[model samples]
Target: MPKTILILGASYAGTATAHYALKHTIPSLPDPSSFEVVLVAPSRHALCRPATPRALLSDDFFDQDKLFIDVEQQFKQYGERFRFVHGRATRLDTEGRVVSVELVKDAGEGEVTLEVAYHALIIATGSSTPSPLHGLNSSGRDELRAHWTAFRAALPSAKTIVIAGGGPAGIETAGELGEYLNGRAGWFSSKLENPKVKLTVVSREEKILPLLRPSIAQTAEGFLAKVGVDVIRGVSVDSVSPPDGGRGEGGSLTAKTEVKLSNGQTLAADLYIPAYGTIPNTGFVPEGLRAENGRVETNPQTLRVEKAGERVYAVGDASNYARPAVHLIMEVIPVLAANIKRDLLRAAGESPSGEDRVFKEDKREMQFVPIGRSKGVGAAMGFRVPSLLVWLIKGRDYFVSMAGKMWNGQHWAKET
Candidate 1:
């Protein structure tokens, strides 16, 4: 008779929680089988979101659903201790401990409430990548991938390229295309159908990577420069529209909308890509919950959405525990799992004389960042491991194989 814990969103944070709890944390607690862990997500597989860039050049990467992870298979080694639900959550009641989960299929979704009551809940819906890639598509597994596929199809023929938003996504897209076009940073030894493809990044901010320290930000800017990316900083656009009534291809109907800059400048391209920012996907959380900046805001240390009365938590992009970073998920999810078990211990009246084990003051630290696939920057395990580690950790195969290994003998588990 284990208490149930329902986890939402099954990407990095959610996946890590399930794996850690099922394999490590839960077993460490008393009567592990008494604490059933249930994971709910939109899909059955965990997608390797970072590799969407490589998929642009390599057709072998286009196995769209192939990259997805099977949660059941991923955690099967844990036996009947875990359950995965494929559905979209409609609402949550942290107070009463109930979640309204909707089972979505091809044509329609079947609605139902979970039978078990939760001793704790983990929301790890993660972030999506759109302009800033702040949504489901931003993970580089969705619309952005589709957009790149379309852009690459026309690349060999296009003469100009204009990218909006100077964030990492914008820079990454520019870098990859430049590499593909010239074959090298050196124009001398390269094969290019067009060496003069106009690449411009428009950002309203005075500098790029605003969240990063100025020095580190400049380092990124320099990297972009080395790759021959033209960055346009501090210029906003009033509206986005095509001039001369759309040229080439299918115009607005088939192609992206032309942009009109606020500086009274008209910029058009064979392809227009938006690398904007992220917004919260808490619409599924119903009402009365605290969500801000298009994301749910919670105390970093506690991970409590508003009050800490019930067993509740949010992780990854869906919950803005103050700052958002992919690497943070690595740190936060483990802390989150530990905290949940601690809460369960306290709730079961199994605490050690008023000492609270459930606390959430985890620090936010970024360890690795890969620019493209081969090169980038980062610091890991407290060594500032350099960009080379980034290449190995994420740049190489985009950690697709590592993700499989995390599942303990399934997925890309054997591919490596």
Candidate 2:
């Protein structure tokens, strides 16, 4: 009887753990058949969300067909050793070590239910962004593509675009819009003289990209200004009328929005995009194992869910780890895979407690904020890099190739 290792969410962290465990653990096990890895997620494909800011504004930048990779196709070579369940995990039974999922693609029935028991569970459900930027909201590839189509159709006619939040998403969006209206990039013709062609970014923080150093943040601000993006800092969006509305049915806004700021001012725009970061998708996570914001609480060193015993772990946005990114998730996978292997070995009566591996998040945080296809800003290994370097490293392709690697070469094909 193989010990089933069930993983929740097939986003970056969850999928990486599955692949690493298969590559590292099975061969080392005394009996390779002693364990099986099962990955459960809402979508049957991986959405390349980082490209959303650019893609939503312009079609030439990214191919919608390549934005997602079918989950099954990416792991087909692994054979029966791995399994991908296309469903949402609605309930978790910690005591029984079982998870209840509602299948996304059921054939005959109204709703399909599945119960999977596991020796270990990894949560990597990721997170969701607000509308007009449904970057991580859809459950499948088709739905995600639909979201992009809607956004593109809505953007062309819009004369004014207001973005809330000064994080990477907001800043990137405003940058792209600024360039589009300036006739620098994108398909939109130059509206340089059109006062109606407005682009603004509102941030609660005093500076944009607060996670970066003041100098780096300033560099980003300078670039945005050059592209005609108006920056408003130290205030938040208090309310948006047509509040829940966005571009269309699938987006957050159905029509133009009248936005109210915390400072008691109003700004009306043709489009409003919220880039305030993600809302954790941990609703199914047990309250005891979760933090205030519903992110799983994990032991800093071990990366195991705090107070949820050694069998459960979490990573990416679903975990308490702040600022989840593809780079960080890749960094955390090895340690997480090793820790799970150690636990399995102990269960098999092989390793002792002292020999168990533990994970530590990289202390030196890093990120790249691309303004458009040819210019941007970034910090790597605690040092800021110039815009040209940012463009060469990430801005050009927006790390589409990296996303391709995540999907195992099925999407975002490399140029030969």
Candidate 3:
């Protein structure tokens, strides 16, 4: 009988631990034949979300190598040693070390009882953007794309646009739209006709990217100006009323509803993109499993989900790890891998005890805030990140290509 290791979710945390374990442990194990590794996830390939947005905004920035890749295909040459199950997990039996899964596809949904008796488990279900921008919400990708395509087609003619929320998503959209206006300097009527062709960003927070320091916010405001984006700070939108029944030349289809802001003010727009916040998708977790704020709570060091016990775990944005989960895939989690290995080793023998496997992860956080594609800003380790580096790293398509490498190494590396 082979010792089994089950992995649930293969985005950043799940895939990293799997590849690390397979590449390092499979060969070093006392007996390669003694263990069987299985990975369970949807979409066989990992999706580079940071990069996905670029496919919508900029074409010059597109790089084929940066696109997401399939994990099952990456290690398929390894044969049956690694098994890939194509399904969605519906229920979890922590004590029994089994997950009740369902096979989801384009046509319809199906069910499968994948009994993974594991010596170890890795959980890495990531977070998701909560609302829709341009009708592109998570109502299902097809529905979103259908709405977004129609909205984008209508943008060229809109004389004014109102952007709600002053977060990174709003900032990025403002920059992109402003650049488009700037490019049409002489051609478009919106650019030639009136200086009041407004591009407003309404933020509830005093400053955008409030996670960043004061200096960082100041620099970003300057960048927005150069790109032709009107920075509306210190005020909130009260209400938005579209050109009613008899009202004249300009009307907006997308933003017909009235939006009331915190401050005593009102505004209207031909377009609106709500790049607001993310929500963890743990509601789908099995009944007995434990979670907080739609996320699975795991031991900070061990990555072992509390309710699920030894048989299950979670990673990426899905884990209640007491920190904003970053999408950067390179930040290593070797300690988690080591702990999983030790647990398996112990199961393989009479007693699997070894050195302390936990190592403190870096407490500091880092971000690369790109204002459009030309300029950027970032901070890490309490250092005010220089603007130039921010553009090079995050601002230019949000570092999607770099993260894709960590998730899908083989095909992406070859593409480059």
Candidate 4:
């Protein structure tokens, strides 16, 4: 019987780990057929989160279909060695090495539970943003699709759009909207330039993109100004009152609302988008193993779950190893894959080839802020990157082309 390496979440981290394990780790093992990978996730597809900012605009700006990759189909090439479970993990028994999953069911059906035992576990459920476009709320595919549809239907009529949060999501979203409504040419051209649409971004911090250098933030602000986006700093959105007719069904973004600011001011918004604050999807994880902020307490060097015993690991936004960023997740996968392989070899009474890997958090300030399709600002390794470079790197299509490669596991490091 094959030992199961169960992976939770199907987004960037979980899917990448699964592919790395199956492609590199299992094949190099003393007994190649002694292990299998099981990936459990609520949604059937892995969301291409980077492209979501443009994806929320009209289909002319981006094809929303490309924003999601079917997770089950991505694993079919592995045949019986890989299994995809469409469910959400509700509880984890670290001592017993079993996870309790709530299988996804039809709308009217009663709940169904499943207990799956694993030899090793990887928790990579990631985190969720207030806006479904930026991150998964863990409500599954249907709700996500509905939210996309709702946003699309509402965008045309929205006269005032207020985006709360000065983080990357908020800034990126504001840029996309600014360009789309102000008529900027991108990967796809949209002739609809309605400058009448008012765009605003609210940030609690003193400046936007606080992670980047002040000069880079200023440059980004300049780009936003070119596209007619207003930046409100030093105050947060205190409360939001829905439109007179309410937020419509499912709390959709269709109706107008009133936003109250922390500085005692109010603004009427036709569309209210909360783009700040991410909640880690780790409710099933034991409290003792989690940090006070609700992220998994992970070994920064080994990527293992601290105090949860052997063979339990975490990566991506769900873990407290480093600040959450797509670039950081890429750096984490190779280290985690190598460690898991070494640990598995020892458990199977075989000598592993390489020494265990250690992950060191990169301290370099790296960020790319695309103000619009044509212009942007960024910095890498303590140096400022030009606007054209930023546009060429991410602003053009938001790396949508990489989505397929990510799902196919080709992005993993060539050597473990």
Candidate 5:
């Protein structure tokens, strides 16, 4: 008899797990129909979240459709072996091994819920930061497109822009805005007067990009300074005033806001964007499996949901496994898939000693900070790459071109 595997979330981690499972389990099974994999997500699109910071700037560089890849079509080659449900998982009963999902539909009707049973489950719901600057919307493509369109229309008249966080997303957004208003560095191509736009970045920490080494952090600060962006460290936002009025036909909102800071200061701007940290999407998970901050607590060795036993696992930002990154997901998927195969083989009365696997943290120091299309700084495998190289590698296209290939293939698979 075939066993069912239900995977929650259809982003990088979820998608990768599904692909690897098919590769490892299907070919080995005498009856290929003995295994089924089902993926459930709020939307059928695997949104390119890393590109959202740059994409929101304008439509000229980002084609909205490119950010959203159709997940169903991508898995069509598998036929009934794979299934994708366009809905959000609202509840879960780990003991019963059943998940309740709310189906998303275009037709105007009441909500519909479905209960799905699984012999094994993977939770990869991923995390989300504040919107309009942090990440792209996943409800649908139309909602995401509408957000970018409105921001671009309002930008020309937005003389003052205030960003509330100094993380990667905030920094990238600051850089893109700086380049859009003023031309390339050391080039005064624009005839506009001095202070074409007042841009400010507020960081609660003592330094911006605090995760990077001091020298590397300095390099990022230097790039922002060269591009005319004000980097203010050790300050936090206290309150933000509401918009004065609604948006006009041109998609520009009439009212700007006054932002109050912890340093006893106030700054007004045409737009106030929050780029704070990410919050784990673990609400659907059981309380016993969650941490104080709402992140799933998983076994460090096996990556299984703690106390929930070996048949269930959690990965990506939603789990307390370091932090979220595309590379991190790439590293986790294969180990998780191998472990699942080992457990399944054991259930089928086969030897499991050589099949079980463990996950270890990848300590390689890797980070690429691109300010705009032309320049950036990075450290790859502990070696500092030149800014020009960073521009060529990631700053130019925001790596959206490579994301699709990375998601659909097993470029990081490892043999245990």
Candidate 6:
């Protein structure tokens, strides 16, 4: 029997790790065919989340087929070396090296329980946001697609759309909506326009993009203003009241939903999107291995699960090493993969070359906030990056063109 290198989550982190193990780690082993990689995730497709902001606007740049890449197809070339399990992890036993999974069944059918034992475990389940429009959360691809359809169907008639959250998702979403719907001449042209809609972004923080430098945040605010998005700061959404009629036409309660702010003000919105409160998908993780915030307690340097055995590892949003960001995810992948490969080599009674990779947290401020299609603000390595460069790098289609490369493991690392 082949030893199973089990990975939880099929998002960018998990998928990249599996590819690295297959292409690099396994090949380095004396008995190459002695191991196989198994990936477990809820959805068969992996969502290209960066493009979601524009995707909400139903942009031709973000086609559903292109945004959601089939996970199974991405690994088809690996053949017997890779196995994709369509399920969600329910429990993890680090000591026993076993994981309890709930296999997704067909519509209207109950989920089937499955127990998988692994020689090594990697947790990359990532995080979830309040709205599926921002993150995949626990919803399957089909369900998420339906959500997009319903949201778009309601957009035409929605006169007022309020987005709550000052984070990247909220700001980006507001920018996309504002520019597409309310932007006048001289702004990036949009094929689909809805000028009747009023877009507002409500942030509990005093300034948006709280993680970025104050100047960068201020620049973002200015960009949003130019795109006709209203930024409401220092107020939180205290309560939300669903429409009394429930499920209005086109499956939206937009016409009647009411949002109460912390400042003792209420606003009736045709569409209310809550983009805050992102929780890591670490429910199945052992309590001892998890931090107070529900993220796995990972050793910042080694990328290993703190308090867990050396064979256990974590990366991406599920790990508490650093704040969740796409660039951070990419940075941690090679470190985690190299460490796992070294450990696996030792277990195989072979001496591995080079020292174990360590992940040093970059203290320099690095962020890119794209306000609209034509403009953005960013900083890298403690220096402010030009807006045009930011737009060219990320704002243009939100890197939708790289979805295929990401899925195929081409983005995992630079080619040797």
| Cα shift from native, residue 165, model 6 (Å) | 0.9
Q: Would you estimate the TM-scores of all the predictions? A: 0.79, 0.91, 0.79, 0.93, 0.91, 0.92
Which candidate tops TM-score? 4
Candidate 6 residue lDDT tens string, 109-129: 986988998988999999987
Question: Which lDDT tens digits does candidate 2 get at residues 1-416?
Answer: 67888888887787777777777766666788878889888788777777777776666777655776677777777788988888899888888788899888655758888988888888888887766355646367666667667767877788777889999888888887777666452335222344436888999999889778888888788777666677899999988888675533564653688889999988888888877857788888788888887788887567788577657988988898655778877766767777777777777778645655555566573778998667898888888888899889888777776676766633212211
lDDT of 1 at 148: 48
Q: Which stretches of candidate 6 lie over 4 Å from their true place?
A: 108-110, 185-195, 243-255, 351-354, 412-416
Better-scoring candidate (lDDT), 5 or 6: 6
Instruction: Write the residue-wise lDDT of candidate 1 on 31-93 in tens digits.
Output: 777888898877666776666555555557445544555667777776788888877677776
lDDT of 5 by residue, 59-176 (tens): 6786656777888877786788999998888888977888999998777878899999887889989887665434433365566667667777777888888887877888888888
What residue pairs clash in candidate 6, if any at all? 254-270
Candidate scoring better on TM-score of 5 and 6: 6
Q: Which tens-of-lDDT digit does each residue in 1-416 have in candidate 3?
A: 67777777766667776777776665656787777778877656665555443445444556644544566876666677788777656666666776665654556644445556676777666665633432222233344444445556766766666666677767777766666565323333323233334566777688887767777887777666665566666666554564331111123335433555676555555665545556665655764454647678777666667677654667677776555445433443666666666666665563555673654456554656676667777787668788777777776766665665466444223111
Q: After aligning candidate 2 to the native by TM-score, how far in Å is the CA of 24 from where it should be?
A: 1.2
Better of 1 and 5 by lDDT: 5
Residue 388 error, candidate 3, Å? 1.5
Overall lDDT per candidate, in order of appearance: 0.62, 0.76, 0.60, 0.83, 0.75, 0.81
Off by over 4 Å in 3: 1-3, 58-60, 108-119, 132-151, 159-163, 181-197, 231-257, 264-266, 286-291, 325-329, 350-354, 359-361, 409-416
* lDDT winner: 4
Ranking of models by lDDT? 4, 6, 2, 5, 1, 3
lDDT of 3: 0.60
In model 5, residue pairs whose N, Cα or C atoms come closer than 3 Å (at least 3 residues apart or on different chains), thus clashing, are 244-255
- Residue-level lDDT for 47 in candidate 1: 70
**Model 1 worst lDDT window (10 residues):** 407-416
Specify the poorest-scoring 10-residue window by lDDT in model 3: 243-252
